[model samples]
Target: MSTIAAISTPAGVGGIAVIRLSGSEAKTIAERFVRPLSDHKATYTPFVADGDTVDETMVTYYQAPHSYTGDDTVEIACHGSLYIQQAILQHLIAAGARLAEAGEFTRRAFLNGRLNLSQAEAVADLINSTTEASNQLALSQLRGGYQQKLKEMRQELLDLTALLELELDFSQEDVEFADRNRLLSLSENIENEAMRLVESFRTGNAVKNGIRVAIVGKPNVGKSSLLNALLDDDRAIVSNIPGTTRDTIEDTVTIDGLLIRFIDTAGIRHTDNPIEQAGIDRSMKAAKEADVVVYVVDATDKENLNNPNVPKIQGTTILAINKCDLIDHINTSTPNHIYISAKTGTGLDELKHAIVAPFKEVGDGAMLSNLRHFEAMKCLLAAIRQVRQGLEQGTPSDLVAIDLRDAIHHIGTITGEVTTDEILGTIFSRFCVGK
Candidate 1:
């Protein structure tokens, strides 16, 4: 592989910036800037390019077979001046190192066996993680917890396949080398495990991507005020005028280590105005797709509250009777409703608890956050089910062996034992430059 270089740190000024290089020429290109230092140690020295001093820098080197990319690697820590960062990167590029693409460094690590595909993805997730739960999820994957689980599942399938295939060698003898009852039992076990992982996608997705909650209601029902109250900041525009929010406004807030994205959408009411109607259409769509829906109703408006026009929702819905301060007596007709004043911040705590109530019982086990993994597990479950059904029907060992191999292949794609260039390209492209 050719040598690659990129700015590993964020752009703009900071205390320090890092420019990284990997491949056979990594150390050599780095040596051109700072004097060569002992491997695995940092040396502070002046960086020079084109016979002119660029900046005083600290350089660290790691030799092949032991570094992140499993190749010779160099990290140049320079002062966080935009000019200095650009100058150093240009110097390396001129010195035979090409610019690194998005996730190219991690891709090389995956190719060189330094990390499995899932773990490589975790590296990107760790960088992009917003909440503490997301951080923990990424860290667990980085530490090989996810990889190990998939590995165990694959190994079990492989073992079963091996035994089943061996029986084919003695077909002429009509000798049963493996017990049929045991094979069926093993197939059932693998299927159950795969399905369990498949079931975790819902909770895992919420943890990784945050719980999506849409604040939906009719015109001027305090939907924007409720959003501001939940976020504890004026993130949305509030006004007495109906249809103030003509588009969906979104922001994230962490509640009990879980990120909750509250989307304040346009008031849901019949309107001839194309813009407001479009916004209302989007509001319904947002509520439909959200993990939780907080339907805000004006408690002071007795006519609307008594006959609430609640849309048919798909997920868990929490009734939030807003503007309680205006009401003389908070007498809610609905039994499972929380009355709150978005302006005065009254009963906000009860509203928050109601939002996360459904997902609170989801345990902290290995879960599937990535859609690719979930789909693979679903495919794996289908294949294993085929194996189980074949075993029950007393089908020939060779036919059962085919489905077993298919199951193994599905599991392999998750950890990248089986992969295509298109899938790899698509997965890595989502990462930012120099990951």
Candidate 2:
């Protein structure tokens, strides 16, 4: 492969900037300006281009087969001046190094067998992670936690395929190479796991994006107040006037490491006005789609509590009684009820706990966050189901082998054991330039 080079660090002026080079001629091209380098050693040298010293920088070299791309690599740490960074990059490129495409370094790493496809995508997630939960999720995936699971399932399919093929080879001899019932049990376990990985996309998506929680109820019931209180910002206008909020107002905040987006939607009430009716329609949709719906109600008035339009929520529903400070006593008859005064911040912490509780129920395991990986796992799960059905029905061995091989292929796609250039280009193109 031809040599590629790019600025690896973030754009703009910082304390320092990194420019990286990889491929067969990386080291040789870097040596044009710097002194002779020792492998894996950082040497401070003057960067010379056009017979003029551009800047003094630190150069580190990594020899082939042990580097990030399994190729000769060079890194230059220079002062973060835009002019100097560009000067050094141009010099390197002028010496036969091509500018790298976005995520080319990591793509080369994947292509060279240093990292798998899922892990390569995780590198992007790790870069863009905004919260601790997201960071940990990306780190866990980068460490090959998900890859290991796929590897084990692939091994199971390989074993099953081998057994079936052997039975096919001896069909004329009337030989039973393995117990069908035992294979079924093992395959069932794999099926359960594939189901698990597919289902994890919910938690993974919630973490990658913020968990959705809609503050919904009749108008003027402190829905906006609750939204502001949750975000600790005056994100929504709080008013005593009914229908003051004509549309949904959304904001995100982190509570105990989990990111929750609280949407203050227009009150759920019938209105003859087309504008207010449109808002109500959107409010209903938000409540239905959110992972958790905060059913805000007034503590002083019980009349607006009964509503026929509250969407049927499939997820957690918290009946939050606002204006609790005004009421002398609290009532907690509902299953997931919380008494809170968004006025004085009373019970806000408890509300936060209740909000993050449902997200924690996804359990501790590698989750499917990337959409590509999710699609691949869905295929894998379907293939596993097909193989299980074939084995249970005593389908011909060769037919079972076809399903088994398909299962194997899906797993391979997840880990880059079987892939094409188009998929690789799409996956790596999402990354920032230089990584």
Candidate 3:
């Protein structure tokens, strides 16, 4: 492969910037501008190109089969000047190093067997992770936690498939190489594992890309106040007038390491006005899609708490009685209500806890965050169930082998054991340039 080079660091001026190169001609291209590069050692050197001194930089070299891309690689660390960085990149390109496509380094790593597809994707996740939970989850996947689990399950299935195939070969000999009882038990366990991973996608997606919390309540019930109080900023306009929040006001804040995206929607109330009705329509949709629904009710008005619209909202509803400071004594018919004064920042901590508590079920185990992985696991589980059904019903060994192989193939797609050009392009296209 031809040499590829790109700026690996984020854009803008910083203390330093990194420009990386990989492929067969990586070292040769680096030699054009960077000198005295020792293998596996950082060598501070002057960068010269086109008979002009550019900048003083540090160069590190890695030899083939041991580097990030399993090829000869070079990384140049230079002062974070836009002029200097661009100049070095142009020099490398002028010397025959092509600009790298997005995620090419990690793609090369995957192609060279250094990392599987799941782990390769985790490289992007680790880079884009915004929270501790997301960081740990991505790191776990990068370390092959998920990959190892899938591989173990695939191997067991593969062994059983081999037995099934052997029995197919000795049909006239009446051989029973694959045990029916053992296959049933094994398939059941594999299906259970796959389903567990599928179920984890909810928490995984919420953690990786902030939990969606929709604030729904009647007009003037502190939906916008709760949003501002939670974010500690005047993100949304607060007014005693009904329909103040004509549209869904959205903002995100990290509470206890979990990202909570607060969507303060217009209060739920019947209105003849088209605009307010549109906002209310959007409010209901947001509530339906949200992971947590914060139903703000006015503590001063008991009738508003019993608003028929409140019961229409779905999902994990946190009944927050706003303006509790005004009420001398709080009385609630429901046991699952949290009394809070959004105007005074009272009971906000408990509300935040209630929002993040649902996501606390995510343990140390690797989760299925990617939709592609989840779909593949769903297919895998379905195929495993079919195989289990065939074995239990005493279906022909050859037919059962087909389903078994299908299950293995779906599992392979998750790890890139079975992949195509389209899959690679789609997965890597989402990565930032020069990954």
Candidate 4:
């Protein structure tokens, strides 16, 4: 492979920036800028291009088989000036090193066996993690969380297959070397583990992508005020006039490390104006699409929770009693009513608790956040089920081997023993250049 180089650090002016290079020629190219580049050592020297010193930079070099890509690698930490960063990169490209593709270094790592496919994918997740929950989830997967278990499952399947396939070689003599009861026990364990991962996808998805909560109600129900109170940012426009908010206003807040995106949508009511009707339509759609809908109501209004008009909602609905500070006695005919003043910050904590109630039990176990892994889990489960059924019915060893091989193939996909270039390209393309 050709030598590849790119800016490894985020673009912009920081205290310092990093430019990375990896390949067989990485050390040779780096020597052009700063000679005597000792392996696993950092040298503070002048970086040069075309006999002109560009900047005083710190350079580190790693020998082959020890670097990230399993090739000789060099990293230059230079001043954070954008001009200097570009100058160094352009100079490197001019010196026979080509620009690196998105995630090329990590892709090379995966290719070199430095990391499995799932662990390589986790690098991107770890980099893009915004919340603590996402960070922990990514870190867990990066540390051989689910893939390790898959590897164990694959070993068991391999042992079972080897035993059965060995029987095929001795076909001349009618003999059964494999134990059916043991095969049954091994396949049963694989089935249970596969199902557990499939079930964890729901929780993993919620932690990976924040939950959506739509704060919706009739006009002038303080939905915007409640939104501002929840975020404490006054993000939405509050007005006494109905239909002041003609679009959905959204913001995110972390409750127990789980992201909850609260969308303050337009009031749901009849209107003559087309614009207001459009907003109401969006509000209805948001309610249906949201995971939870907080139905806001005025505490002082004559029509209280006794007969509140809640639009048809598919998600969980919670009754929010806003402007409770204005009324001394809070009367609610429904048991699901939560009295609170968005203006006075009353009962907002309870509202937040209610919002994340369903997701409160998100465990810190290995879970499936990737859709590819989830689908693979399903396939593995199906294949293993067939294997167990075939064994129970006294199917031929060769026939049983087919399903067993298929099950092993599915498990291999998660760790990348069975993969294609297209799949690798698609997975690595999501990463930033230089990894």
- Candidates in order have lDDT scores of 0.86, 0.85, 0.87, 0.88
lDDT of 3 at 133: 79
For 1-435, candidate 4 gives per-residue lDDT tens digits of: 899999999989888999999998888888888867988999998998889999999999999899999988999999999999999999888888999999999999988999999988889889988888888888888888877777887887798789889999999998877878889889999999899989888668767888889999888989999999899896988999988899999999998888889999999877899999999989999998888889998888866557888767655799998899999976677778798899889999999899888766545447888888899889999999999898889888899899999999999988888998877987899999979
Candidate 1 residues lying further than 4 Å off, grouped into runs, are: 218-221, 232-247, 266-280, 298-312, 326-335, 357-365
TM-scores of the models, in the order given: 0.87, 0.95, 0.94, 0.86
lDDT of 1 at 71: 88
Question: Which 10 residues in a row give candidate 2 its minimum summed lDDT?
Answer: 302-311
lDDT leaderboard ranking:
4, 3, 1, 2
lDDT string, candidate 3, 206-254, tens digits: 9889999999989998889889888999899888788899999898888
The deviation in Å at residue 382 for candidate 1 is 2.2
Q: How far is candidate 2 from the true structure (C-alpha RMSD, Å)?
A: 1.9
Please write out the lDDT profile of model 1 over residues 1-435, one tens digit for every residue. 799999999988989999999999998888877897778999998998878899999998998888898989999999999999999999999999999999998899999999988888788888888987888887777777556767777886687678778879877777776677777887787788788878778778888899999999999999999998888898889999999999999998899778999999999989999999999999999998898888889987888887787777767888889989998877757756888999899999999998877655544447778888888889999998999999888877899999989988998988788889977987799787777
Could you say which candidate leads in lDDT?
Answer: 4
Model 2 Cα lDDT, one tens digit per residue, 354-407: 889866643334677778888988998898898899998988878878888888
